[model samples]
Target chain A: MKIAVCVKQVPDTWAQKRLDPDDKTLDRESVDGVINELDEYAIEEALQLGEATSGEVVVITMGPDKASETVRKALAMGADSAIHVCDAALHGSDALATSLVLAKVIGDRGFDLAIFGSESTDARMSVIPAMVAERLGQAQLTFAGKVDVEGSTVKIRRIAEHGYDEVTASLPAVISVVEKINEPRYPSFKGIMAAKKKPVERLTLAEVGVPADQVGLAAVASAVESFESAPPRAAGTVVTDEGDGGVKIAEYLSSQKFI
Target chain B: MAEILVLADHSGGEVKKVTLELLTLARSLGEPSAVVVGAGAGSTVDALAEYGARRVYVAEDAELDRHPVAPAAEVLVQLVGPHSPAAVLIASTADGKEIAARLAVRIDSGLITDAVQVDADLTATQSIFGGSVIVKSRVTRGTPVITVRPNSTAPEAAAGPCEREDLSISLSDGASRAVITNRVEEKHDARPELAEAAVVVSGGRGVGGADGFKVIEALADALGGAVGASRAATDAGWYPHQYQVGQTGKTVSPQLYVAAGISGAIQHRAGMQTSKNIVVINKDPEAPIFEVADFGVVGDLFSVVPQLTEEVVKRK
Candidate 1:
């Protein structure tokens, strides 16, 4: 079996992400970047599937050159190789346009299965994998918490309102991994060393056969104009730890009609 | 005339509330047309009409109804090929997002998911990275495809002269990528979905144990609120992950959010900080939850929640 996992590098959520004053873009200078948390689950699921089926796991990412770091982490987690579709032109591409580039590349590779995190950490749109499947004319399963591979059939479970729902898709389909699917493994020292030598294939729009008219932000059907922060949270009405604190709290709730 | 296509999300003929919410959003852009593909769709059409659908495109077939996502996309692609909707709005559920992505690719359009607000100009506001940031974007070239986040819009029922149109679509051989080998549906009473609830009561590490959550549940019931928990509570195995409301959990934007014994980490805030009004009950005055809360009480949750529940029930 051949499995392809899509991952992306995003600013660490804990890092203070300020908007760049010049262009209103994210301020990258002070932030640390890492593979999106959800994508880690995808890589782990692919590796586990590989272990079960005696297959190879190929990690795929589309971003600027630095995105190789994200792919390297996947490589360090037992993926056999990595493919990085790197180019400056791909920058600022929305989920739709980004998936266009990804679908084109994966179509060429012809993998048995493709996986992605439910959504990217920064964008969190959760649209790319399904778009890839649509573009490639493949079956798609999203937000899967559990995926079991049996020959050419794939059975999966996804988070639902009350509980989980099971779904089955044929091979050569697209699946988006959710958090509950698996606990992602930490990169091991040996795997880290091996990742340095893992084959990292780089492709650009020209190599992927994407015409200039078919890529970039121009291909995006939407654009953001301006934004402002959500309303600042109001300061709480503090009460001192006085006598009968519980009584004081109850009285407050009553007075405010919250009770 | 350009129409805004809404993929009806329903099960057993009961339309999900978000379907109406999406219709409300679709109306903001243009004429709202519902694409109903599944069982009991005639009832769905009526429901869609009551909520405000100008047209209902019905795609009824065995292959389309039994399995929802892929065939729905196939139906939409056929709809898109002829109708050429200005935008396609789907509820940003797990299934909905997948279908939207697939359809976007089939039509070679720009796809944006988890959009909190879809504006008239086509710019969509999305709460990304667990609601830490709100970024707006639009697809520049092809038709705009988007999945609207839950609770982003209030469903407004506008009676419309809904016109029903039957759509004939042939399912692609590739449509059934994954077959449904088995399906297990969860059984629960009619309870308010967490995202759609106006009031929410959540617990965290301070709840102590599984039994300790009973008081929180009572309080939530008294307030007609949905129950939620922090990642810490979920991680500790006190509650399931679905009840968790934090960065890695579900995002909720209720009108009133009551946090009991929660420390309010940035991650937890990412899921619910957008709430209209916040109230926190914790022993520690310095708990970060207070920073974002409009109301705070420094007391033990065990004692306070019960009294609050009792009072609320009495008032009701």
Candidate 2:
């Protein structure tokens, strides 16, 4: 099985991330960047499946220069090789453009399975994999808590609103896994050293067949008009437990007409 | 008036609250048409009509429900071909977002998900950075595709002549590739869904272990609300991941949120800071959850939860 996993470099989850005032894009330079926490699971899943089938696990990422760090991490985690799609014209690309570029890259590679984390943290839209699948004209089995691949068939226990549905799709499908799938392994010293020697192929829009005009904010469909900090919530009454704390809460609820 | 298509999410023939909320939001933009797709699509017209659906387009087909989201996206794409609606609105569930995503790609449109509000001009206001920063955005390309969060709009009743239209669609091989093998419905007895609940009671690390969640459940049950868990508690194996409320889990905007034993991390706050009223109870007085809480109680959840449950039950 030829497995491909898409990893994204996002600002540290713990960092106070902000949008650049000039472009309304993420302020990637101000904060430390790390592999999106969930994408680690995606790479891990691909690595495990790759090892099982004696296949190659190629990590795919599309971002700025700093995003290569994320690709290196995936490589360090035992991925065979990495592809970094980087270009200045890629800035401010919405989910559509980003997926368009990713689909083009994956289309050229011709992988049997393309995997992604369920959603990116900053955007949290959780729509890229579906968009990519739609663009690729393939089946999308996304939001999977568990994924199992057979010969020419893939099955997943997709997390849903009520419970989980066991979904099956043919090969050459798009699969996005949730965090519950598996615990990602940390890179070993040997693996980290080996990752430094692994091949990193860098590509641009021209190589992917997507035009510069079709991507980035200038050609995008959606635009963020303006933004501001939400007003701070006023501090409410704080009461120490005086043996009547529960009673006091009941009184407050009653006053608020909750009970 | 231009049509505004609203995908009515349903299960077992009953329409979900978020669809009504979407209908209400779509009315602000243009004529609201509710698209119900499934074998049981006809059963939800009354409820959709009650919430101001001018027309309910029912597409009855097993293939649409058998697949994940591709079939539904195809249905919407077919509907949009002739209607050319002003915009498309869907409930921002996991599947809903994916449907909107694929639809945006097929239609060459801009997509926005999890919007808290929508203006008349098709602009959407979203709570970002864990509900701390507010951003206003709009679609600039082709047709705008947007998803609305549950409870974001107060559903108002506007009795409409709910005209029924049957849509015939032949699924392409692209939309029919994925097949659902099995479905295991969630087993929560009589408890409301966490996202749709008006009141939510959540537990955190202070709940101790899996058994400690019983107290949390009791409180939620007493108040006739849903049970939620902080990421710490869920990660610690006290609860399931689906019940986890945080940036990585389900985002809930409820009328009232009672958080017990949680130390409000930015992640947890991001999922629920938009809640109208918050009450936090913790042994630690300095837990960050108190910063945004409407009421804070400095006490152990073990004691406070039971007592609160009893008080609520007695009041009822």
Separately for all candidates shown, the number of backbone clashes (residues 3 or more apart, or on different chains) is: 14, 2
RMSD of each: 2.8, 1.1
RMSD to the native, candidate 2? Answer: 1.1
lDDT of 2 by residue, B136-180 (tens): 999988889999888898888788788999988898887888899
Please report the TM-score between candidate 1 and the true structure.
Answer: 0.91
lDDT of 1 by residue, A1-259 (tens): 9999999888888887666555555655467888988889999999999999999999999877677888889999999998899876765566667777888888999999999888775665567877787778777777787888888888778667757667777778888887767778999999999999999999888998887566665555566655556556657686644445445555665666666
Q: Indicate the residue-level lDDT of B49 in model 2.
A: 92
TM-score of chain A of each: 0.91, 0.98
Per-residue C-alpha lDDT of model 1 across residues B110-202, encoded as one tens digit per residue? 777778888897788876544555677777657787888777888999987989998777778777655655556562344577866778899
Best by lDDT: 2
iRMS values in order, in angstroms?
Answer: 3.0, 1.2
Distance (Å) between predicted and true CA of B75, model 2? 0.9
